[model samples]
Target: MSFGDLLHQAGGMGRFQFIHVTLLAVPILMMASHNLLQNFTAATPEHHCQIHDRDNDTRRLNVTEQPGPTTELLRAFLPLDATQRPANCLRFTAAQWRFLNPNATGANATRADVEPCLDGWSYDRSEFASTIITQWDLVCDFRRFQQMAQSIYMAGVLLGGVVFGGLSDKYGRRAPLIWSYMQMAVAGSCAAFSPNFISYCIFRFLTGMALSGIILNGVCLTVEWIPTNVRTIIGTMNGYCYSVGQLILVGVAYAIRDWRWLQLAVSLPFFIFFLYSWWFAESARWQILTGKPGDAVQELRRVARINGKKEEVDKLTLEMLKCTMQREMASVKSTYSVIDLVRTPTIRRITCCISLVWFSTSFSYYGLAMDLQNFGVNIYLIQVIFGAVDIPAKFISVLVMSYFGRRVTQAGSLILGGLAILANIFVPLELQTLRTSMAVLGKGCLSASFNCTFLYTGELYPTVISKVSDDEQKEKILLQTTDIEKTKPTG
Candidate 1:
């Protein structure tokens, strides 16, 4: 019998599976918080150039018994921009006291000399008590620094996926995952207390690296333990957990209002997750394929006991494991590398297609999700709406996949999502309602596309190529070994 039968004999999908999946899924809620954290933490606020001390004195001396409005006073020191709002980056070199007159127009305002904000800038903290933007004065000339910080964090994410994915294959899923949790806790908390922008970016980059490790290893562990029949449903549930996390970020951000505190709030929970992660059993399949059948048998027996199959698993031993996994072991004897992913024409084609799909979905998804403030609505409300849309989007995706099939669902979602985003370009900027609606639709479709891609790609690639690569070679050899066994004669 195959390993699936062994799992069936050990009380499949019982108490142990329930608790294991639940515990593993909990950290995922926080994953969304980290991914979308910048929405609140880096939010830009209304600001203007600081008035000079001399300008302040001049205003005091020039005040009449009945002072003019604040807007009128600002008009003397700041020039109006194209939008008729006071300029944020420039101010009149010398106060134009004439503009203080009630009927004064800005017809000659362009003739007045202007200078850059030499003193600094003043931020309106009505919405955010503080953010990266206000904390470091990342406005006017320095605004691009904010985007640069995010780029650094994303670079860490890209490298982490490659580094951790290979590390898990070599060292096993549990170790990398445990280390990831601790790293996230430390790095994320350190970022909250960062002394400056550079230190903050450094900590955020490390935190981004840990994020990939947690997600990659977590998914691997969850999928490897459960029955194959339930994988799709369980995977979708995990995706939903991420969606719920987005909503959680809104509430926490609204309540906290300060970037440092909000960053700390999302990070500290991983310490608890790290503590409990040690209790997780390593994947028995990984253990056996790695030539640790004895450990695999022990872990299996433990699982059986927890699932209330202690009596049935009494006969479960190394000998039984060796016999059942004989073919799997044989297949792994031949060494393979990551090149094997594209070694064959069919596999190569599949890899290229899926890569493009993943890239497009991610590019579109983050493009929309990260620009919440541009929607011109309350950031908190818009964030909630974005997160909530994922729920229905994912649910409907599952139903469609179950009926119309994975390929159709995957293609349809991407097309519809791209169309929605494209449609917004022609719409007038004045139509905020239409623009926001289109963006929401696009974001939801992309979310569904992500959900479908995860399950679809897993099904497309064989387990050997997916699971057994080492850091040096970066390939999945264990599943390759199993596939070899399937081809053997049944004498």
Candidate 2:
């Protein structure tokens, strides 16, 4: 490219701005689309128990009268031949609510004192855990099958992380991104139409496996694209974009109550992402060091152009080509190993503590969010509440990380979330207003911590965890447990 041409590329601002926004927006979009998985199983379909009679009769179960809570609870412990069924909540006495769980080792747990079972044919998200396991098929297989599906997906992510992360670094970010997105879109759509349990599990597994490639590297690609000055803000903001993904699930699920439609809704848009490379460049940092300085220079010229710098573009681009190649090559040659992450006393301590923090935070955050449906509120209302909190929590995160470093802010958020979860377990049902209030606070900070961890992990691992690092084993471990989300749903 000529000097003036370079200058023109940089000087002209109109189209370049759009390109920058478009390129950076993918990760945000990827993160945004993540909500479909996170919230799907938490959502349940409208169902009710069909009371039946003893064998030798083909008559459908009668619902001539609306049964009260007691009848509902004792309906489980009765003889089908009984002449009459009691409809009062008082009929079940204090014995049965505890029996729903049937394994609670606690004494004195009864309908009045225990959590109530939901009846009727509407969504009941609070029972997501129970519903998926025991409430499904009225035989407890619902929750069990739900657990298996999620577990398989998590397992796929583990494998994908190994396969994809290496491929991302080895082949450069663009190719795997192209391949995986296409696969995910197809697999996700197919999963919706799966006719059997095995088919659903297989397709969903492929969907997540495909996703691990894009979402994991998308963040790295963004980091490499932008300068360090505002990386935190950019990454966190991108993380908050996950709210958009969740919101998408909200709209889709609300509109299409069937799981099959929801599955189709979640997985169909990534085809455009498969074509993203036609308009975008690979990570310039990765390219320059990978002995593709000329290509990297071309990409940088585009970025500089987008940034609207008109002066000495070709000269600066050439200089980068010469100097950046060697520096980047040297850095790549020294690619990190896990040993470097913990070789020093300080490094190891930081690594251990932070790893613990990441694990604990992930475990608690998902555990709580999945349990939100069990709180006896409207599932839609609960979702709206949780989602609404995420926005403010994101806002606070931008401010908090600005005031304090990532470490401090993350620690504080995790601590608060941990305490809140503990507090919620003991909060009385009568004081449910306060219980919900605590839930809001806990979930918000938990959401914030979840966001904060991504930013923190990216910063903490630096050369070690970034594609820059060569500690394949360490990365494998990290990715193996990466999602750390609901392995199995609990109602």
Displacement of residue 203 (Cα, Å) in model 1 is 0.5
Candidate 2 lDDT over 85-174, as tens digits, reads 322111222233343454543232322322112331222333343222222342222445665676787677667776787787678777
Highest TM-score model number: 1
TM-score of each: 0.93, 0.73
lDDT of 2 at 160: 73
Model 1 over residues 1-491: C-alpha lDDT tens digits? 67676777778888889999999999999998988899999999987777766655656344321133355577878899999888989988878888777787778888899999998877778799999999999998899998898888888788788888888878888999999999999999999999999999999999999998888888878877888788888989999999999999999999999999999999999999999999898988878778888888888999999999979788898888888888666656765577877976667887899888989999999999999999899999999999999999999999999999999999999999999999999999899999999999999999999998887777677756543435655443333211111111000
What lDDT score is found at residue 281 in candidate 1?
Answer: 84
- Tell me how far candidate 2 lies from the true structure as C-alpha RMSD in angstroms: 9.1
Off by over 4 Å in 1: 56-69, 465-491
